[model samples]
Target: MPPLSEILKTTTTPNGTPWLTSARVGDGYLLRYAGMADFILNGAGSQLTCWRVEPGVSADTIRHLVLDQALPMVLNRRGREALHATAIVTPKGACAFSGPAGSGKSTLPASFFLAGFGALGDDCLPLVEQNGSIQVLPGYPGMRLGRDALEALSAASGVTAPVADYTSKRRALALPSAKNFPREPVLLSRIYRVVRPKEGEP
Candidate 1:
């Protein structure tokens, strides 16, 4: 049982939360999120080791945290271009939707899923380049779409999209909580960035 302190330097974040810190640990990165899940992502960004905190936390919450933070960070450091994008697998190939916050990144991919394509993930897509080819490494299979987005999908398809999980103003839009993600990597085809026109212009 090697303690994190022996393997890496420690630091504190002043964000009034228990997300202690993840530092450059020996040949890897260490993470302590919400003072619960203690984990390490190996230098290759291919392996992870995790443990529960004293009182334990929901595995679902830990999974979400790892997707949003640790895994992306590790992959980015390992030379993959981690995009702030959502991705879907179309018949042609994998397509990415990238933009800043509030740019409908999640909604667009969800639309593709409804149109019969498969969702790679709704956020945190990593592009791995090899031998002059780019591949879309899938993220967690889920879409965090707003209420209106879900409603629109339901109405258009005439099927009530199940809410996999609850958030503040959105629901985790996936069958049985998005943990059922596909693993096959798809070749990169196109990436579309969302842009909105001025209110009075269009």
Candidate 2:
């Protein structure tokens, strides 16, 4: 991996706070997430290397960024449609909830999980087309939820830890009895756009 010479791109939070910087390095790219970790992604999008690590950053925080953000970006570069969505498996197959940040994407899936639905993935749902149908690929074995949503769902027992020190969200395992983490891609059946309720609406 060569040194990141010049930044090709920089991404920010929904509120426009800078978070990630990317530079084209040789045939791949180097991504820098300030105060966390830097990842080197192969041009093929098949390999990821942790090029640098900042002291005191938890492994979980690095993992969260790799899976939830970095991986998705590279996958998109590889021509896969990586949606910012949460996928839940229902009797009808897989349904995805997609929206911008703070739009209940994870919370709605948490509710469905409590109701006995299996989860395919969260926050970076990858989709592949095969044999005339779109399939939803599985992501990490858990989802991240904010403190309030975790309390509302009564799912504290499954929480492994805080997703990162910078946020109040925690990573929680899918319910054991809910057929979690489908080993095979499930056919995508539908998609729903999720949004927060307007003022005075329940």
Candidate 3:
């Protein structure tokens, strides 16, 4: 079988950039970009999957893919359980982070991870209803953090890794575990909205 990178490079979309060209590995899809990669797994039959890529891809790019492409695909393909939220989860429901671009949504989640909280999602997290309760899909193994955000987190968490190895326009970073790198999808839970206050507005 061709390596996932080779598979992606071999395929192309109408615009020339590889859109949905990926290889199926186990229960997940390994997506390879020119300089980065991520995995998408089937979350409860929902086409939307938790995304984790090598540190470098822009968070804005991730947003565009998830919101513009992936989310819609899930809704159309798996309407039974559609989620619209950016969140992380604990044993008690889900904590969502909602905000616009560059609003620290990704940073907050990374902080949570360094603080020992499990990652539910970073850029695009799925929300679902289970047993009349809202649930969020535990996101992929890691997230992309901004430079300043990484520095702050390092100070707080007292855990530092080479940003050079995990830095990008979005400053990507992996969660604090190797097992969290799932080769499959996950279920959904709650949603959180992360945002930055307006200048001088509180």
Candidate 4:
């Protein structure tokens, strides 16, 4: 079950995690974080509110709140599960990679793009059940990577594609537009999880 934040208007510190406290205000949720901006996410997640308590906060912060946090909640309300995964379209079909942070979920999709594949989604991948089978939804047409990560991709064909500003940790680039990476949901063909091999392993 989701948190009862909508009912518990006050008593934010029932526990110790301040970030988890959410209150309802006129059919919306307001989440406050110490030393950071308070985010007011609408019940439907169509609106976002942020009030920065300090400087140096970038607009990307709010974007993440909408894309990664609020949007998922909205999807959940519609009976969908948002997974922390990155997916790409290949000659075979759409493939997704999911794992913890620093698990190369983003980098693997970036590599697929450089290798002449199309990216379907990055960071947040949506899954839905249809006819008793699970399928992956088409997502944003960009991959987020660091500036240094662009070196190899830019040199792939000497075209030197430009990377747009995305977030503090990465750059965003438009993925290829073609039938291979169509902007429509496709049947999930495969999923890979990248992990660090223990030392002494081949």
Candidate 5:
């Protein structure tokens, strides 16, 4: 692992804010959400750039500035569309879950992990084209679960970690209890659309 400065070199745009001098890293890339929005790549020019500031500077903010602002820049630069869902790859194909906030997109995928499926991504799922197939980036090793959702997962999987130990900056759980933690990104597969009914509806 390299230091943040070594791995990422900061540069100031004309307007004057720190942006990454180089962004690409190995098989993956880096998207910086500092003052302004910009994608840094090891290759030539930037894939995208944004002229907005994300909501919060704290690591615990739920309203992700990266997803809200930088994602569009990435999509436009890469010529892709954004999808609001969690993506998991199975033997059959890619599966994606899409719904509004609090619709269980995060918890349902945890169930999949307990069922022996690999963890793809949670919350912000990116759509990418690779090898003639549309693939979504597997999420980093993290899952964001509310109190109730966390308790339910604890019951079913018998895995529990301290809530305080989890950070909002990254969706992560350090569990020495059940020894269940995602180490890698799952392949993109199926797509599931989740819908929650209103106060009264069929």
Candidate 6:
């Protein structure tokens, strides 16, 4: 991996604190998440390398950042559309639920998994135009959820580990534990925008 040099882009948290930075390094790009991890993606988006910056950073956290965050940046640069959504493979095809943070994007798919429908992706749903239609690509087969949601979903038996040491969010396996997780692309049939119920509106 090439060494990171001058910063090229910066992404911040909801409260405005810098969260991730992208910098140029020879023919590759370095994506740095302060105190968490650094990822180097080659210019062609074919190769990737990463390491944790802080001690005690779990491999789960690094893997999460790489797939859910860094890879999306690379895909976007390659002209693929990545959405903040969760997709499930239903009888009709793939149904995607998309919205801002705190929406039911992740939870919705967990529920679908319980109903025997396979989850296609987690929070980062990547779409590809294929054969004159849109298709949903499979993401990592791990879903992160709060303790309460995890408990309700599967009695928390599928919980593997916390997403990060600093947070209580845990990853649950979506395959055998949750029933199914499709590995192949599914045709996109519908998209629903998930939203929290307004006051007194059910």
Global lDDT of each candidate: 0.67, 0.84, 0.52, 0.64, 0.53, 0.79
Question: Candidate 2 on 1-202: residue-level lDDT in tens?
Answer: 6866678988888788889999988888899997788899888988889988899998888888887878898888889998889988888899999987899998898788777788888899888998999999888658789888888888876745778868978888756524556888899999999998889999
Error of 3 at 193 (Å): 3.1
Residue pairs in collision within model 6: none
RMSD of each: 5.3, 1.9, 9.3, 6.0, 10.0, 2.4
- Writing each residue's lDDT as its tens digit, candidate 6 over 44-162 gives 88887884467777787787887788878888877899888887787889898888877768877777776677777688888998999999988876777888887777738754676
Candidates' TM-scores? 0.67, 0.91, 0.51, 0.69, 0.54, 0.87
Ranking by lDDT: 2, 6, 1, 4, 5, 3
Poorest 10 consecutive residues by lDDT, candidate 1: 157-166
Tens digits of per-residue lDDT, candidate 4, 40-132, equal 666776666664444665566556555655566566655688888888877676788988766678877787776777777777778877777
Write the number of the candidate with greater TM-score, choosing between 3 and 4: 4
On TM-score, the leading prediction is 2
Question: How many clashes in each structure?
Answer: 0, 0, 21, 1, 18, 0
Quick one: best lDDT, which candidate? Answer: 2
Q: Output the worst ten-in-a-row residue range by lDDT, candidate 3.
A: 158-167
**Error in Å for residue 91 of model 1:** 3.7
TM-score of 2: 0.91
The CA lDDT at 102 in model 2 is 90
Q: Whole-model lDDT, candidate 3?
A: 0.52
The Cα error of candidate 6 at residue 175, in Å, is 5.5
Residue pairs with backbone atoms closer than 3 Å in model 4 (clashes): 145-171
Question: Model 1: per-residue lDDT, tens digit, 51-119?
Answer: 555464555556666667567777776777888788887668888988875678887777767666777
Scored against the true structure, residue 103 in model 6 reaches a CA lDDT of: 76
- Poorly placed runs, candidate 5 (over 4 Å): 1-57, 62-64, 67-69, 155-170, 174-189
Give the residue spans of candidate 1 off by over 4 A. Answer: 1-20, 34-36, 44-46, 51-56, 155-183, 195-202
